[model samples]
Target: MPVPPATRTSPGAKAPTRPPVRRRERQIGGSQRRMADLQPGLDFTNVALRPYANVERMRNELLRCYLLSPPASEIPEAISPFTVQYISCVLATYPRCMLSDGGLPPLVHRAQVQGQEMPRALANCFSLVRMWYQAVPGSEAMVAGMVEQEMERLAGKPPGQGDYILLCTFQAYLLYSIMIYFSPLPNTSALKYKTMITLSELACRTVRNGFSCAAEHSHTRPPWETWIVAASKRRTFVTMELFRIAFNAGRLLPSSVTSELGDIFASGNRALWEASDRDSWGREHDRYLLDWEDGMLNTSELYRPEATAQKERVERWVQSVDEFGMMLFAVCAHIRGR
Candidate 1:
């Protein structure tokens, strides 16, 4: 044992130790593989931005459809140059949200739009409205058929041509507004969908009631235009009904879905009002009663900001069914002008 230390190492011998590292081999290969797997770019930090994004997108569509159709009287006169410019400017986010081939449609992007070289979904929307203007009677039926065609092309996938849905919805609201104004008897029975009537269907029922009333009493020669207006209103009503439910449901559904739905409803309602001939309100209302009701709705609007969150926020959204009643009343009043 005493002789071991001297014998263990010759004068130039070295102690056992790890080998020196080479410059190129500093890292273990497996670590680099794991890091690559984790970094493929799937993230969702921008969820809150979604609603605003969809609103902006739909606003553009509304503006575009409005321009394409123009007022029947003003058509062939260079579609309002200002309106086109305004919509284009307002919808600046569209390029980011535009759909691409072999990917989801515009609506499906949730937060971000991605793709390359696909036909613009907005183009389909303009075509639907243009077709509606062309078809005199059964315009609703024709538009519905066209929308179904777009739906089929998208094959139950997200971002498939849903702007058509918006068009249908807006038209329905117009119908409901008409019904509230003209019809003495409410057509509540027709409000059910497949099994249960959709909100749009309810709007249709109201508009149909108005159309019946207008046909019976108005001096307008072709009552079919009344019916067409009624049908458009009905479609819009149904859409808003669905949207109210979705918006109220909030967290129950994906935020993206609700946001888009809200955006559609807001823009659709505005468009319906703008496109309508306001001076075209047919008969005068009982002045005294009209003023009273107007005051109530105006007051309600003042409180709407406070109610917006209470009515549409996630925790309280579902409980906000009462809000729909208000919307219905307001829409009815607008159509009736009372």
Candidate 2:
């Protein structure tokens, strides 16, 4: 074979070579997934769309969480009359989310909040939080220790009584954590280190005993009871990571709960969650329950909508969730913001 003359090269230029085949093969192979891994032949039509009935109300609440600060719209009286504006308003007026609601009837017969009695644990937490707000005479050690003791009560396995206690305990913990984090009390700093440990214990509990009613919906379980069990667990589980982000991100920075942790629980339809009676929950809410598999509303799904079938059903699921569900949406939205 005859040799060709070499071409001139720039001073810094190096000789060209063939493309990297192995690197490309590895990159392409990583993209490949098994057909069975994708779970073909599944009904995954929703994987059934449970459209939220209260579209307008749901929209308003989502806007409120994502947009409203200092909570101007629903403020009663004048803003000038307040001591602590946001805290006072949140305590008095912020709509109850599942974390706070504990799957109970706030409106008895779907009426007024009077029908539901405050959980005793929560009532006690309120008193403890009061000490934070009022600057009642107490040492940093005393206040932080008191809060720690309360958290300790719920730290290990839940009571033998079951989900009801579990729900209330978490509600109490949520109140405790939020109040301390936002409180002006000197002890708030003391709690910073402690909050991490408390959060870890909570995460373990969610993994071990989080959803007691993770079974398929049936005549055996009342619609309301099952919804409460799952939502409470999801709310608490998500909140722990929510706090973790809030802590690490500066007293002054924040990771989202869902994407960081592979939580697959769904926030079910609101009508079913709020229904005061079994007859009221209706078939629509009952028809699609959170199964352990296809039906789960994984946090990852926020990024991968294609895995789900119906857009409207997803909207309904997103809208139907109580404030706790809205809280998760807010976190997911922040993830996209980053």
Candidate 3:
């Protein structure tokens, strides 16, 4: 075959070649086309940003009001004004999806109307937590001073004070420790851990002493009001133990604390605790205690294969009692090694 006459080309000329189109370029083009198809008037700038500005303004107003107003003296001891304010702030700051239905407002309202008496130490703890939340200047020192005063007050009390008082003290200490541990302050991790350990130990000791007194009256059926107090003490102790185990992963804390209280061994049956009237509570108490003591329904039975069915029953019971009861079940399950 005769070679074709050389294709005409200028000196130093190169053949043209198409550049490869990248995947990213194609994607950008597709997205641009899709965006172009949408209506240009559909602007979301104000719709997205206006709520945030509104929230910021509302928060500033709330803080200003709270700071300017004189502290409320008539508020019940059982209710912490700081906690209520903190909760209100949270609700105002976040979207609805991030918030709970009511957060602690109902409890505060009840405390106000009923004139419920709260333990002094626990009240102080709430104050300390509120300070932490506010993050005011010198809050740490203020918290420390308050905690020291509380500790001294607790120390000065007679060793044989009522179980109710002692239980309150322990809970207060635990709450203080928890608040400090999770605080946003920097350079406090060591202090937080130490505080947690010390408080846990103190709580264990207090529980031992307080519950010993509670056991003496356990044999008799007390009035509905008295029984509620006793039940609260038991629940508080168990809750402390659960928190200890969870925080330390059962390594630093023992699996269980020493206690002879029957409440610890009882099923997570909330009916007994939820009885509205004295007569109903008394009746439910008897039945519940009887069921607890019955050999067939002990805590050991909760771990068996048949216990799977019981889980649903416990869940159903929790429906009537709400979150507190569910928490009880969760602690119970953990205790049973489930």
- C-alpha TM-scores of all predictions: 0.21, 0.53, 0.49
lDDT per residue (tens digit) for residues 1-338 in model 1: 45655536677889667788756522221233232232234232211111122333433332332233434564231223343333233222222222222221112211111112213444454354345334556455655556445534433233322332333333323223222222212222221122112332333223322312232223232222232233333334333433333322321321111122221212112221222222222222222123223221211232243544433332222222232333433442332233
Better of 1 and 3 by lDDT: 3
Q: For candidate 1, which ten residues in a row score worst on lDDT?
A: 44-53
TM-score of 1: 0.21
List candidate 2 segments past 4 Å from native: 1-120, 134-145, 156-163, 212-214, 217-223, 251-261, 282-284, 287-296, 306-313, 336-338
lDDT by residue (tens digit), candidate 2, 136-157: 5666657777777877776654
Question: Candidate 2's C-alpha lDDT?
Answer: 0.45
Per-residue lDDT of candidate 3, residues 1-338 (tens digit) = 99889767788898667798766422211243332232223221111100011323322322332234424663212222343333233222211211232222111111111113445765565555555556566665665566556655654565455555555566566555444433435433333344554554455444443332232234435555444444455555544544444444312322232233223433334565544345666787676556434221323333322466666544444454544444545444444434
Pick the winner on lDDT between candidates 1 and 2.
2
lDDT of each: 0.30, 0.45, 0.42
Of the candidates numbered 2 and 3, which has the greater TM-score value?
Answer: 2
**Model 3 worst lDDT run, 10 consecutive residues:** 44-53
Tell me, what's the RMSD of every candidate? Answer: 23.7, 23.6, 22.6
Looking at candidate 2, the ten consecutive residues that score lowest on lDDT are 42-51
Top candidate on lDDT is 2
Best by TM-score: 2
